[model samples]
Structures are given as structure tokens and as C-alpha cells.
Target: MDVKLTEEEKIKVLNSDDIYGIMQKILLRESKIDQNREHFWVIGLENNHRILFIELISLGTVNKTLAEPMEVFSFALQKRAVKIILCHNHPSGELRPSEGDKDITDKLIQVGIIVNTEVLDHLIISTKSYLSFADTGLLSELKKSTKYIPQYVLEERLKKQATEIANKKKTVEIAKEFKRNGVDNETIALSTGLSIEEVEKLRVRKR
Candidate 1:
């Protein structure tokens, strides 16, 4: 792919406010950008929080824009950015993130993890206002969401959890057997990996 940098002054981005200011400037200067249509942009950032590059990733209809992860990361990777923030305009002037916005952000976050490029935030901006996922703590919550975990990682976690559950069941069965055979609570606890209190509770339940 062809990558080129146009002449622009160096801009430092410290937070979401800085990003909003930059977006506002872009909206004013770029007459080619249709204000009636939704436009998605990927903002690449250096480790020191300076702007590396801003690439327009996609343009969609009035309310929705598509941001493919590959396309988003391509600019980020090409710029050698360590972090990225996603931005998109909503012609409807709504700040709330739609389900599609959340879904794409989640997918991009997962892809960013795989590609070693951290996704810092996703901004849904209108002419007058903006919503920041990171500022709202939605980004942290999205990281915890299990919807986009890689299949192999999910399977490995499930298998490990299953093994732990099976081992606990086996230990409980052994403890019950020891209790039935007239074994002392202390002996049952030591033999079956159960606490003495647990073995005593088992004895009571057997009555």
C-alpha cells in the first residue's frame, strides 16, 4: 500500500480533549469530508502521547461507518505507532455508542492485542459533543468482555477450569469414602486434601 505524509504541524495529544480539539480542526479544514456522512479515523500515537498520523479508515452512511481491523491497524503499523485511538463522526449528533460501535470496538481491541498495538480509546463524535469509551470506563469493561477472546485461548481456559472442577469433585468423593470407612476427620482431611472442618461437616451430613 502507498503511505504518504502531508505537511502538517506537529500536534501533541495528551487526552481525549486534545483529540476532540484535533478532530474539530480537521472537520473545519478538510472540505472534502462530507459532514452528512459518517467517517471513521484511526489516530496513531507515539509512546510519548504525540500524534503520529491520522488516517481516514472508512466512510459510511449518515449514522454508521465501517472500521475494519486490518485497515485500521495497517496505518498504525505503517506509522510504527505504539498506541491508537479510534474516532468516528455521527451526523445524527448522538453521543451514545450503538451496538455496532461497541462490537467493532471490541473486535478491534482484540485484534490490537494480537498485533501488539494497544487500543487506547474509541470516540463517537458529533458536531457539538463527543463520547469517549476510555473516559467512561467502557474501555476497561470491554477488555473484560468475553465476546472476542480467541477460540484457542477460550478453549484452553475452559479446559483448565474443567480440570480444576473435576479434580475437586474427585477429592470430595475420596473424602466421602474415607468418612464412610470410619476414618478420623484429621486423617480424612489430610488424605483427601480437604480441611478438617470440611471433613467434620461431611461426617455430620452423613448422619
Candidate 2:
């Protein structure tokens, strides 16, 4: 944990891949300390992806840990983290996500929305391998509320915005074609879904 970093020791995390690599090392180091029951860890990061802190949320039994959203988020909230990554160890060496794993991820994602913190991803760690919720499409299936949008949701919205812009450009072209064929501004508006003023501007351009 770079929590002890001085002002001169600023470590910038470039992206999710960077965090995943860092998390693997952190989990492996923690593994040496305890090889028994499961441990849930919460890692907080600033908007620029700088590490704020890493904390243990709960130490669970063989298969389960009671994790409340409030407890999971308490530290991140205190540190003013804009995003968080959830990491937990599986004693059984199974990389698969358990029911409890799924439950906490869902709960935390919703809690993040309410508190203005976004849950970027959840990682299931084992000594041999790791499973990423973002990689497996589970992160995409999380229930989102109107109150908050997670990073993955924001990426999706950006994609839609690009498509909408392309469609509007196509509509404008169609309107020009209509005008070229002697179509009225009212008719062009109806056919291309452009405003009457937009059609008039195109007509003036053609003239």
C-alpha cells in the first residue's frame, strides 16, 4: 500500500490493468500472512487513479463473510475516494465467484451510486490465478440506479453518444438529398426528422 507515500512519492496508476497487477501482488503478499479463511479487501483510488489506501473489510470463514455496504464503504468514504476495487481471497483456491461474492458486489455497486463513489471492479484472488468481474461480464449485469452511474455504465453511455452523433449526421445528409429533389422544408423535416430551421439552412446552402 502506498498509503505512506510522501508528496514526492506520488504513484500514478494508468488504468484498470495497472490496478489489477498491483492487487495481485498485494493479495499474494497477504497470502503469506494468512492461508486460512477468506479476507475481503477494499482498495480506494482518486479520480486520477492514485492509490489512497487499501483496507480489510471483513475476514470471513471458509465460504462466507458478512459484509455490509456501509462497512465496505466506510473507509473509502472517509478518504473521499471517487472509485474503488473490491478484492477477496478464496481459501479453496477456486477462482470462481461464490454466491456471497456475487451478493456483495451487487450491494456495493448500489451503495456506491448512493454515496457518489463508483465500484470499478471486483477481483477474486487465488494463489494460482485471479478472476475479474469486469472481464467475465458480471460487472456489466449489475443493477444500476438513476441516482448514480458506474464507470462501466459511463463507457456504455459514451458509445451510445458516438452512435447518436453519427445518426444525426446521416439524417442531415438525407435532408439535403430531399431538398435537392425539390422537397418542401416541411416535407424534409418530416422525412429526415430534422427541424424546419435545419432544413431551411440546408436549402440556403444549396441555393
lDDT to native, each model: 0.83, 0.76
Model 2: per-residue Cα lDDT over 30-133, one tens digit each: 55546567878888889987878877878777767677788878889888989988888787888889776787788788888778898888888766677889
Clashing pairs in 1: none
Q: What are the per-residue Cα lDDT tens digits for candidate 1 across 38-93?
A: 88988888989788888888878878778888899987898899999999988888
Q: How does candidate 1 score on lDDT? A: 0.83
TM-score, structure 1 vs. true: 0.71
- Model 2 C-alpha RMSD vs. true structure (Å) is 8.1
**Steric clashes per prediction:** 0, 0
In terms of lDDT, the best-performing candidate is: 1
**lDDT measured at residue 80 in model 1 versus the true structure, 0 to 100:** 97
